[model samples]
Target: MSSSPAKPTSQHTSDHFRFHRPLAHLSGPFGNDSFALRAEAFARFFGTPLFLGAQTLIVVLWVGCNMAGLVHFDLYPFILLNLAFSLQSAYAAPLILLAQTRQAARDKAHADADAQHREALAVANETRLAAAALNSQQMLTLLQQNTELTEMTRQLTERIERLTVEMHERFVIHGSAP
Candidate 1:
């Protein structure tokens, strides 16, 4: 009697269905990886081949002007081009770094927010449980008190009846003697 192995259960099947429902419109297209997004932004801004081509064209134009004697021996165009490229690099590097830092901070903030939400939910659930327990205890105490009061009332009534009968017998016997 050999038994077949059980199939493995899907990990996120419920979550997938929950998000894919018609009314669930809160799903996002992006995953958790922000580094890839940041890298793509950096590439779009600074790593395009077109920028290199433009730089090369500028250099060529400066060289051509210098060679044709149309410019001075100081090579001012070349100096300016180099200065612009240097400045662009300086600023672009810092901007990219800043973007990455901001992304990290944003991710951290999201994680912190999720943690806080979970903590709040846990506290709410605990409060509900505590309240339910307190209500149950109070109900039990009230029931016990009601039972004790009922018993005490029954005992007092019985004692009053016994005393009344004894007083009536004593009064009747005294009246008959008179």
Candidate 2:
């Protein structure tokens, strides 16, 4: 087995993967907490009875003026209404874009934090594994040393016994001659 790190080969390349993918082309930028907050704000602003009453008042005033023949079809009231709608659309688009940008930034921050946490966890696990390997190696070395000491003790005991036996035989042989 090779000790080198694994490298991606041609077989691992994805046909569908694009290196030049645009950020604007990706979806789900508005699918976050800030976007939800902005949507809720929009709903709250537009869904109020006060807003409805104001709209009704404007429509009634326009119709009343039209019926009374005080305002012409090509003049003031219709133009004002069109201007208001255009302004609302323009402002709403930017506000929604701002909310989506904020949400995307928040999501990116969270993703970065998660990546950092995973990296820390990987480092901790590697440290634990290295410590375990070191402990195992130390234990094996100690056991080998212990076995060698026991064998040395046994050999020393055998040599002591043989020397004692030789000394006894010499004593017996000399005493019998005397």
Candidate 3:
């Protein structure tokens, strides 16, 4: 089998990230916050399979140990487990909301940047179209002028031919009479 060489790309194709340059200052949400960043990460971890599986395994072990009489830390009611879940929920709810709010802000910035880029492209397209239209109009006017000059040259050539023929006839007739 024969292999084909790679096709060359234009400069426009290489500028895919040009639209994102303006959003550089708005990186990682509206502003930088070490605590908020950590909390966001923690909140994100709460929804992952790894955290869920680990939590489930721990709860199972706790119940198994208590039921088997291996430990007397909590009775069958499992009030301690309930309190732990409540505490986790108390922290998780606010952190998740914080993460969501930051994400929404970042999304808005990106959308605005995209809108600006699109507007710039539209303006450029209009400029190019206007220039093309003007060039076309100028070319048509030049063509008209060239056609008029050609017609004038043809008329002058015909006049010169007629004058030459009349002069030749006069010279032949007058010379013969003499």
lDDT of each: 0.70, 0.72, 0.85
Worst 10 residues of 1 by lDDT: 23-32
Model 2, position 24, has a per-residue lDDT of 30
- Highest-lDDT candidate: 3
Q: Write the per-residue lDDT of candidate 3 for residues 1-178, one digit (tens) a residue.
A: 9799867778536877878888776665424589756766788799999999999999999999999999999869999989999999999998778777878877898998888888999999999999999999999999999999999999999999999888778788566442
Model 3 score (lDDT)? 0.85
Provide C-alpha RMSD values for all models, in order. Answer: 12.4, 13.0, 4.9
* Whole-model alpha-carbon lDDT for candidate 2: 0.72
lDDT of 2 by residue, 45-140 (tens): 665899889888987887778768887773545677688779878877766676667667766766666677679889999999999999999999
Residue-pair clashes per candidate, as listed? 0, 0, 0
**Which parts of model 3 have CA positions greater than 4 angstroms off?**
1-13, 30-36, 171-178
Instruction: Give lDDT: candidate 2, residue 3.
Output: 100
TM-score list, all predictions: 0.40, 0.49, 0.79
* TM-score leader: 3
Error of 2 at 91 (Å): 2.9
TM-score of 1: 0.40
